[model samples]
Target chain A: MLDVADVHTYYGEGYVLQGVSLTVEPASIVAVLGRNGVGKTTLIRTVIAFTPARRGRVMFEDRDITRWPSYRIAKAGMGLVPQGRRIFPSLSVRENLEIAQRAAATDIAEPWSLGRVLDLFPALAERLRNGAGTLSGGEQQMLTVARALVGNPRLLLMDEPTEGLSPHIVAEMKKLVVGLRARGMAILLVEQNLAFALDVADRVHVMDKGKIVFGGTPAELDADETIKKTYLGV
Target chain B: MTFWIINTLNGLSLAMILFLLAAGLTLIFGLMHIINMAHGSFYLLGGYIAITAIRLTGGFIFGAIVAVIAIAVIGAIIQRLFLARLYKQEMRQALLTLGLLFIVADIAFFTWGGDPLLVPQPPLLQGAVHFWGIVYPLYRVFLIGCGLVIAFCLWAFLERTTLGAIVRAGMDDEEMVRGLGINVPLVFTGIFALGAALAALGGVLGGPLLGMFPGADFEVVLLAFVVVTVGGLGSIRGAFLGSLLVGLVDNFGNAWFPQLSLFTIFVPMVIVLALKPTGLMGRV
Candidate 1:
């Protein structure tokens, strides 16, 4: 459903995503794995046009969207669970969800509603009126994911969804990703955790420096010792 | 006792006007982070336009409405054409808006002439109301009521509505709001226009008591800056409390100790800043 063709992105003078290409079919989870500073985040940002691709094209649902602004791209069915769980600190949890509801892509049948998201994260439902800043790290991460889901996009771009969470919370996150994929939501997950990526990813792409160095099934990636040692530092 | 009561009423009336101006200032700064130095020009322009509209339409309410609408349109155009390009560049935004302040002031001077002009009070609020052996202008009391109504409406809008939720969210993390598929630029324009409209409404309302003069724009703008600074830069509730504090101090100080009036106004601000650098309700 989404295609990235030899995308090149840069952060000022530093080359980030160098001649990178990948694709995610409908209802599949494509996880990009790498160590810190391997341009994994840049690839996600490039897809969302936060860092516009300096070269190459991005096609979503058979349309060229490389030059579209981030908001337009989002409105056209791209939901971003950005790195760092950037929830609106001063706002209540309910306010955050309500704001997302305004921009939700309405064409999707059985769009993810507030009720459905609350069902997924009951903790958030209980803390609806509480300030988002007061939420714990795990709750904040859940809120971030719920915020994205409320937008009801056809494709989701999640950057390091399991970062900085405990083991149980990480397990919950993995389950959430699996659940989303089962519901036919295509997701592009950028992750540093190897086991979590292997657990949820339908396809795996290992990136290094600024390019994808390996692509295969999670089992194939796990079995390749040299590739993991060179790119991911195992 | 009567003297104190009269001065207190006068202080509250002036505070109401200040609140109207500061509310718009704080909201614009809070959401956009643009120090619109020219905001006072909209107030001055609104007063001048209302004066002309009143003369033509012979109705105070209609004149006020026209002035507000006109200034709102002007603010939206300026934001779209100029301020939109200078986001995050406070220096450029300041210079551009400062330039606008001067240009608008000059235009008002040319059109309205140099002398202070009095806004005609609405017929219903033209007389004085007598109570407890003291008298107060009915118009001034109406101004206070207007301020209260406006404060409530603004509070409700910011705290209770979906669009307001987006604005509040945008204030915290604009990039994330955009990532959520919101048209943030559109929200910005709408907010700028709303702020301008509020300032214009204040101008029309305050014209009768404050009088419209060439330098009134800068005077009120300076007072607004003081209000925003003392209340916390972006907090609307802070603006309200700050406006009342500054207003009461200015009026009561002038009544009881004219020599210390100017000093008294800054005293509260100094103390507030010393104790809480963020202003009363400011975050960060």
Candidate 2:
């Protein structure tokens, strides 16, 4: 559903994403695994045009969205669960979810609704009137994910969804990712957690030094000890 | 006792006008992060337009409405054509708006002449009302009522509606709001226009009492800055409280200690700032 071709991005003069290319097929989870400072987040940001690819093209549903602004790219069926769960702190939980609710751009049969999202995370339903910043770390992560789901995005870009969470919370997040994939959502998950990535991702791409050094099935990646050790530090 | 009561009423009437202007100023800054120095020009221009409209239409309410609509349209045009390109370039925005203030001031001088104009109160609000063994102008009471009604409406609009929620969220984190597929530029234009409209409404409402003179724009604008600074930059409730305090101080100072009037109005602001660097209710 999404094709990122030869994307090269920069963070002010530093070449962060150098000639990286990847594709996410329909209803499949593509996980990009890498160590710190390896351009995983840069790749996601480039796809959404936050830091637009200076030299490459991004295609979503067969349309070139390379030159589009961040908001336009989001409106064209992409949702981002950004790093640090950047929820609006002063706004209530309900306000956060309400702002993210938009009509789906494409005709996705049985799109996500507020009721369905609240059902997925009942904890959020209870704290509807509470400020988003007051939520616990795990609840904030759930709200972040729920915020993205309310947009009814065809493709979701998640940056380190399991970061800083307890083991039990991480397991729940893995289950949630799998559940989203089951409901026909394409996701590009950037993760440092190898087990969770391998557990949920249909395809895995290993990145190192702004380039994708390896691409294969999770089982193949598990078997390749050299690539895993050298690039991912696993 | 009679002197105290009359001065309190005078303070409230003035405070209501100041609240209207400051509320608009805070909203524009809170949302757009642009210090629009030209905001006061909207007030001045609104008064000029309202005077002409009242003469043309022969009614006070019609003229005020026309003035607000005209100012709102002008605000939208200015935002779309001038301010839109300067987003995130705060220095440039400030300079550009300051230039606008000068240009507008010159235009008003040339068009309306330098003489102070007296705006008679609406016919229905012309007389006096007796309260607490004291007489008060009916027009001043009407101004206070306008302030209260607008305050309630604004509070409800910002709290109860989905668009209001988006605006509140946008004020907190604009990037995240845009990431959620909202057209933030459109929202910015709408807010700028709304703020301009509110400022214009204040001008029309206050012209009868304050008198529309050549330097009235700058005077009111300076007072508004003090109000927002003392109240906190982005809080409406803060603006309301700040306006009342400023109005009361100004009125009582001029009445009892005319020599210390200028300094008295600023004492509360200094005290508030000394205690809380971010003003009364600012987030940061």
The best candidate by DockQ is: 1
TM-scores of the candidates in the order shown:
0.96, 0.97
Error of 2 at B95 (Å): 1.4
Model 2 segments more than 4 A misplaced: none
Model 1 C-alpha lDDT per residue in residues A114-164, reported as the tens digit of each score: 998999999999999999999999999999999999888889999999899
Prediction 1 global C-alpha lDDT: 0.90
> lDDT scores for all predictions?
0.90, 0.90
Cα lDDT tens digits for candidate 1, B14-64: 888888888888888888898888889988999999999999989999999
Evaluate model 2 with DockQ and give the value: 0.79
Q: Write the per-residue lDDT of candidate 2 for residues B1-284, one digit (tens) a residue.
A: 99998899899999998998888888888888888888889999988899999988889999999999999999999999999999888899989988998999999999999999866579999999997788899999999999989988888888888898888888888877888989999999999999899889889999999978788888898888888888888778878888888989899989989999779888888999999988887754
**Candidates 1 onward: DockQ, in order:** 0.88, 0.79
